[model samples]
Target: MESFSLLLRGFSVALLPWNLLWAFVGVVLGTVVGILPGIGPALTVALLLPVTYDLEPVSAFIMFAGIYSGAMYGGSTTSILMNTPGESGSMITALEGHEMARAGRASAALATAAIGSFVAGTIGTVGLTLAAPLLARVALTFGPAEYFALMVLGFSTISAVLGETPIRGLVSLFFGLALGLVGIDLQTGEARFTLGLPQLLDGIDVVVVVVGLFAVGETLHVVSRPHHASFITKVRGWTWMTRADWSRSWKPWLRGTVLGFPVGALPTGGVVIPTFLSYWLERRLSKNPEEFGRGAIEGVAGPEAANNAAAAGVLVPLLTLGLPTSATAAILLAAFQQYNLQPGPLLFVTNPSLVWGLIASLYIGNLALLLLNLPLAPLWARLLEIPQPLLYGGILVFATVGTYSLNSSVFDVGLMSVIGVVGYFMRRFDVPVAPAIIGMILGPLAEQQFRRALAISQGEMSVFLTRPLSATVLALAVLVLVIPSLLRLLRARAAHQGRP
Candidate 1:
């Protein structure tokens, strides 16, 4: 009851007219960037972080939270309309959502996605509010070794298991970790890889890396190709979900919420794992699995629910332990630093207003998103009519402007070109960009923690395994890396023996 009262008070703060307006604006901006390919919540939030430096704390947090939630909703729009997934979390939705569009049931697909998303986001936020304190207590017990091991597990699972190929994924991760090493050494302040350049000493900015790899890379890749699809889609029929659609969708939404939270709480890539897991679960239990690749409504409902639920679930660990399980969450963590705040076990006590108010705004933001997206679906779908050249060209310009605005560094713009070219080749070779981003973000943090753990134990490496939680996380990391090799060997053996 005490927690409930505090949460209500938090809602009172979030419900202020000014905060609500910020939330609305954040959602709109989030949706626009989400509809565009390449740019996402991470890039948008990163670009906006400095701008928030002078804003009021509550309103700034409200806007950032709205962007966090809205990005999930925005990704589904592109997945359904363009067959180009707005983000990796929506890839599963694209599988079914795009198919539904082809079946001329785009409205049904969009309706169910929006509703399921709202349900999941609301429930997941409730779960977070209820469970966060207990989770934080568990996290508080973790020593440096445990945190280091947990980070290792996070890096291994996200990089090894989620991409088109584990090799390509690791290669991409290596590229990122390599880039992360470009800055001066933290412990000694010695230049490791700067090659005597003054620009390299300050380390590459997160904004520059994100903009270069995600924005510029995607734009260049798109420009390299010439798309010839028709300008307009034939959107038809009713916009509201029918009773039958509701009956078919509600169960998956529930199941997805249940499946999504724990995975989201874990230190893997944000919502992608849970979204894909829900899609696979729905397909397996579907009354007609054949309907899966051919416009199965459950596909859209389940993944969308899981996507938002997972998005909300990620907030629990992020706020409680300062462990960002996804790229966007990492950027949010940086935003916390930007505000001279740290988010870990002590955060609730230290910054109760910011923490609880952010949680409360989540409920408000989810409702706002549902209302905004329902009748506005057609407006977003119109993006399909814009010429790819013009759209991607605009992306190139915006990315350049945003990057330059950060530091006005012409050298960063030049470096962006280099990173963009590398990213272009990475995409061409089926390498996943998410892992690269994750690796870049987490690499230095992990190194610092690893060093701290060693210092605490007098350089004894066995401390990592002596701690129960550390051992578990390290074992999971090893298993994650080794399982794919085992599976490949098993497949090869079966093929050689002509076994089914």
Candidate 2:
């Protein structure tokens, strides 16, 4: 009842005319960028962060909610039409969506995807509304030791789950950790890695790193790669789903929401896994299983629902725990910092209006996306025809502008270029960048908690292990890192024995 009252109050804020306009604008812009190949929601948010600096936090976040949901809705367009997934989450959508396009059911494919996204997004938002406060209350019980242990678990799980190999992921994490150390030491008040550059005192901006890695780095890689032509299927007209389509889609939409929300709220269960699982599950449960490899609407509906639901679920940990589970969540964490607001249990208490208002805006954003996407999808499909060189060049320009605007310093721009080059190489070598962003954001907080725990224990090293909750979390972290290697070793040994 208390939560419901707060949510009603949130509606008051979200329904304000200017805030509503921002939401509309955000959905429109998010949809536009999401349709473009290689520019996912994370990169879109990073590009806009600098521009949103002057806006009120509530309005900025409201816009971001729209952007987040709209992008999820829009990414499917390209996946269905061009067979080019705007992000990893949409790859499953492309598998059947493009096939549907080829079979001249492109409009039906788009309709099911849009409606399914609306259903799952709304359901997932309801989950977040109910879950975040309860989780925040639970988190209130955490001591510094427990918090540090939680951070460790986050680091371990992210490194283990994100990249192709845990080793590469760990390397990326450590790289971010090293960067996190460049600013002034919080405890000692001494410079560590600034190397006498005064600009380094405040630390490297996350916006810079995000833009470098996502925008500039991605652009460089695209330039170096061999060009591939994309095909866009035109939507002949606004189309409605048939009764058969609804019969098959509604169940997957519900099932996807069930599967996606919990996993997405986990520390390392990013959007990609739930989407893949939903597709696989749909295939197995599908009445016409043979249709899966063809133009099955179930494949399009289920995975798209899971994708949006997972996106909404990502907010749970971000809002309640101050942990970012995906690339977009990491950038959203940065946005919270931009407003001098810290996420976590305290945020709910300190800024209930902001938190609940953001939640309310999500519901509004979902509606706005449904309206915007259904009619404008054909127009958005035209975005697929944008020349890669021109699109990427515009991204670089925006990246430079956004970074330069951060501190009005040319030095920041130079640093962004350097980081961009590094990001390019990271991409080239198949290193995952999300873990690095996660590590950079959480590394400093982890360090602070570690020092606090030690201080409370009077320099006792056993404080982390002696505390029951802390010990449990640390044990989990160790298991997360060790289990994969143990499994691999066992598999290798079994293969060797079989050969002999």
Candidate 3:
């Protein structure tokens, strides 16, 4: 009853005029970003973090949620029409959607993806709403030690799961942490990393870092690639799915949603694992098995739904436990912290309305995306025909304008250029930027909690293991790190002996 009433209040907040407008802006901008190759939600969200400084926290989060959800939907347009995935999640859709397009069934492919996204998105939101309350109640009992243990688990998981090298991930994270520590110390008057640069005193602006890392990094990434748009087959057919399409697609959509949520909630490779699982399922269950790689509707519908559903689902842990399940989630986690809001068990009790409002707005944002995409997909598609040089030039303009508008700080722009150079090199070396952002966002929070926990126990390291829940969580964190290495060693040994 308590949580139920709180949810109603959340609806009230989400419905506010200002929040609604930002929701619209976020969804529209997010979809545009999604349609543009290489400009994903993570990068955009990171870039836009600076703009939210003026927004009410609830409105800021609602906008962020819209961007996150909208990007997932926007990726499909290009995948179906151009055989190009605007976002990584859309890769699965390209397999089948592009095929459907090739068959002159572009409309049906687009419709199935749009409708399936709406259905799965709503279900995922319901899951978040229902699960959050119960999780919050459990979280309310945690002490400093437990909070510290939980944050450690989150940090370790994100650093370990993303990219090829855990060492690089750690290095990236420490760099972010070092950046996070640049401003005046909250606990002490000493400025640690400023090095007498006035801009360093306030810490490297989150906006500057985000815009540079995402927009600039991405632009640099694009210019380095091939100059021409590659040839892709044109789409055809009815602008809607047939009855046959509906019959085959519903069950897979549900299954994809189910499979995606838990994976999205864990500190794993976000949608990657769930997407593979959904694709595997559709392949195994399809009546026309050979039709799959050749462009079956089920192949297009399931993974696209799973991908969006997983994107929505990852928000659960980020909001409820401060655990980011993906690279994007980590950025959103950073956004929450920027507003001085720490998401955890205490969050539900302290800011029920904000959490609930953000969740409710997700349902609205998906509806907004569907409505926006259904009519404007062609416009999005037409964008692809633009020459690469001119297209990238416009992106560079938006990146600069957006960065400059937030604070009118020239230093921020300069910082963006420097980060862009670094980001360019990181991509060349295959060092993932997401883990660095995650480490930057979560490092300070985790470090503080860890020290707080020890302080409470008078520096007794045993306290980390003495509490049942903390010990269990810490033990699991240890297992996630160790089990993989052990398996790899066993495989290496077997290979050395030339055994099958």
Say which candidate scores most in lDDT: 2
Q: 1-500 in candidate 1: lDDT tens per residue?
A: 66697798788889899998998888888777777777789888877865777898778888989998888888888888778888777889988998888878888898898899999999999999988877777778888898789878877887786676678778878787888888799898888789888998988877787778888777777667776664234467665777888999999999999888778977764788788789999999998899989999999999999999999988887888777777788788777866778788788877788888899999999998899888888887776567767877877887788777767789989998888888888777778777777777677878888999999999999999998889998999989888998999999998989965
- In order of appearance, the predictions have TM-scores of 0.94, 0.97, 0.92
Give the better candidate number (1 or 2) by lDDT: 2
Error of 3 at 124 (Å): 0.4
lDDT string, candidate 3, 1-500, tens digits: 76678778888998899889989998988888788776788878876776667778898889888888888888888788778898877888998898888888888888888888888888888888887778777777888778777766766666666656666666666767777787777656678788888777767665566667777887888778877757555544336667898999998899889888767766554776677789899999998999987889998889888888888778877887787767678788878878888888788878888898998899899888889877666666676677767877877787787677766887778888898888887777777677667666666677677778888899999988999989988887777777777888999998989964
lDDT of 2 by residue, 1-500 (tens): 77899899999999999999999988987887778876878888887899999999999999998888888888898899989888777889999999999888898999999999999999999999999999999999988999899889989988898888888889999998888888899899998889999999999988888888888888888888887776778877665788999998999999988888888988766888899999999999998899988999999999999999999899998999888878888889989998999999999999998999999999999998898877777877887888877888888888889899888999988888888899999999999998888888888889999999999999999999999989998999999988999999999999999995
Cα lDDT, all candidates: 0.83, 0.89, 0.79
Candidate 3: TM-score?
0.92
lDDT of model 1, residue 204: 81
Candidate 2 lDDT score at position 72:
87
Rank all candidate structures by their TM-score, best first, as comma-separated numbers.
2, 1, 3
**Candidate 1, superposed: residue stretches over 4 Å from native:** 230-232, 237-239
Cα-based lDDT at residue 327, candidate 2: 80
RMSD of each: 2.1, 1.4, 2.5
Candidate with better TM-score, 1 vs 3: 1
